[model samples]
Target: MNNHLLRAALDAAERGWHVFPLRPGSKRPALHGEERCPRTGECASGHRKWEERATTDPARIHRAWCGRPFNVGIATGPSGLLVIDLDMPKNNSSSDTPSGVTTFKALCERAGQRVPTTRTVRTASGGMHLYFTAPPGVRLTNTAGTLAPLVDTRAGGGYVVAPGSITPGGSYVVVDDRPVAPLPGWLCEALQGPRRTPQPGPVPLATSASRYAAAALRNETQAVATAADGTRNHTLLRAARALGRLIATGDLTRAEVEEALSRAAAGNATQPERYYDDVIRRGLDWSIAHNSPRRPA
Candidate 1:
């Protein structure tokens, strides 16, 4: 067992993140297969989904790394994580900006906000993984280039190569030290697309109040980030309403939530401050009308 990989896996487990082994130098899950395994000749077992093999148990992790040093793979769904993958532009087009970075900036601007600097990992390809916790009851699916060109996501059923993991290109390096923030409602809805509504489930308590606020703002940023110009206001208003539910929980005050959301809305120059204020006020109003003072039974 490589002491480095063992330490990394143990650290991740300590943080409550589930992990698994990837082939020594590849992102593919290290599974046994009999058929010809392209990535690693050691595999004799058939193809396997990484999610199914991921685990939080310390013993299992120990077993996986006891003999060979493997790349660390973090399962996103079980770990309550939502990862924004920003890939560098493939070609040197007219613009210097990578499409992913441009699109991500556009998303934040549309939401009138700034993307939270949370736990970030720089990929070997000079890309980045923006780690955020998934909101209670929200299950985002894995996506590629759907949010914008070169922007991908690792949600439920997806696995992100961990920070300490090494690859042929380079190592996945952590760029930020902040804790993972929550996934905001706006971003959640946008990533969800026009698909079926997520079934109602228990809302998990957030790690902290500040993280909760960051999560809410992240959603607002996403909402604005992906929405078209003409419908931006309506989209923001809708996002404000979703945020209202968070305010209703009593962990966050109205002003605090509004301020966070306003920052996300600030990116849009055309929408006056008063417009965002009005939208926020209305959203809060809806929460006040519907939310009970007591927590749900």
Candidate 2:
């Protein structure tokens, strides 16, 4: 038995952080999945997820860790922790792309603030996790590249591996052992700002607006027709915007563009017909507003 790991689990629970077991030398949870559930003991009622089973009880912690030297997994949601993960770039050779730490520091500078001192953990991969108490009544969820490149947040329905966990890559260790700080005001404001929606890309034209409008139309609409489930709406919206730009130059009528886009997007659109219409309407509206009306001479 690894006494060090056992102590680590107990220490996290002492801080009221809900704890669960992760597989030894790995970040994945050790909990049984729903498919493997036997409908007995903990699963008698139903399958309990790792988050639901996470506990702060010392006795349970001792019992779970006594047999194997399991790594610790903390349920950030139940613990009321919002962990900002500053990650390193996957391709280390890329000098042009900035790491999350660099971007996050720049963000703090822009907000006229400094990065808050908190209980920070250095992960096995050398990334840093800044632990903060989430604001009451605000349930933030996980994000991918939401703040900047290689930056992510773990909240409601997310988990983080605690310090003292070791993986094949390296060891998770405490770099700065300061007390977990409250979520900073600047970050809270940033999080609450207007959610940014995805915008369409640059307009497409193979040649002259009049001569190439039909070719452009065929290409864009064809893209929407073959778009798969998750990307279908985005494809439709982009096509609409590109075509709407042609409408602005009087190369294509709005009626024909709308009908062609709608027909192309019908089967593969993720939502109802009304949703497709709204996306098309907004995409076209945005393109028209940004472009000046002109008749091709």
Candidate 3:
């Protein structure tokens, strides 16, 4: 990636993208002579004496893995650091359109609270990453996760923001709160509104929507399982799927779902069995509520 692309990745990171340091030799156009690890700060594996000069500096290592000019950083507040990733939509042009910009602006306005410097990181797929410094006492988990439907932090505190990924024309902006950009009251209200929870109510499991929900639950089960093994990709994917299922079903109580999810993550029991139990219990409850004959006085 070029400087522009690197800057884009930075912007995306700021917006809560799960930025990972690429390993060397994984470069598409293989690094010719020498290489180094981006994270470990070590010489590239199996370097010959002739290749020493080619692979020593951090910049070269980053270039080798990233194949671009960028690094990922999170907004570490007085509390902790937040790692993020951008999940861009399939269409790339969405970022450059008016609606895209408006959405991006709205998200920044909502998150712009006592932030200072903003930096942009470019991504491999012609996108941008944005970063901003958080203020004292503000927690990344508190702000990033609660700001869902707009942004979310996965299990390990990484977030994936929409419309800001490598999708055509997708871009991110790091707004410095210290400068105090004028923001709409409604945007603030949306950001400050109480967090929404999954509603526990009777739902028609036989409908098309319920079928989709069941599939989603299965996907979530797989994701959680993969995450248990310490794989980043599956963990993030599972979290997203699970969140979608919760939104779609609207039948399982949030508390129950959360408890089930927590148990699944613990990996003490077989996930599929546990998941089946939870879903079946939910269905049984729904049936009891909907099908039971009314009591006569």
Write down the TM-score of every candidate. Answer: 0.59, 0.64, 0.26
Task: Kindly list the per-residue Cα lDDT of model 1 for residues 32-121, writing each as its tens digit.
Answer: 543634544222354455675677888888888999989899999988899999988776655665667678888888988786677889
- Candidate lDDT scores, in order, read 0.76, 0.85, 0.38
Query: Each candidate: how many clashes?
Result: 15, 0, 38
| Number of the predicted model whose lDDT against the real structure is largest | 2
Model 2's alpha-carbon lDDT is 0.85
Candidate 1 ranges beyond 4 A from true positions? 33-49, 91-99, 195-297
Q: Which stretches of candidate 2 lie above 4 Å from their native place?
A: 195-297
When 2 and 3 are scored with lDDT, the better candidate is 2
110, model 3: CA deviation in Å? Answer: 9.6
Give Cα distance to truth, residue 16, candidate 1, Å: 1.2
Off-target runs (Cα >4 Å) in candidate 3 are 1-21, 24-88, 92-100, 106-117, 142-156, 159-297
Q: By TM-score, how accurate is candidate 3?
A: 0.26
Candidate order by TM-score, decreasing, is 2, 1, 3
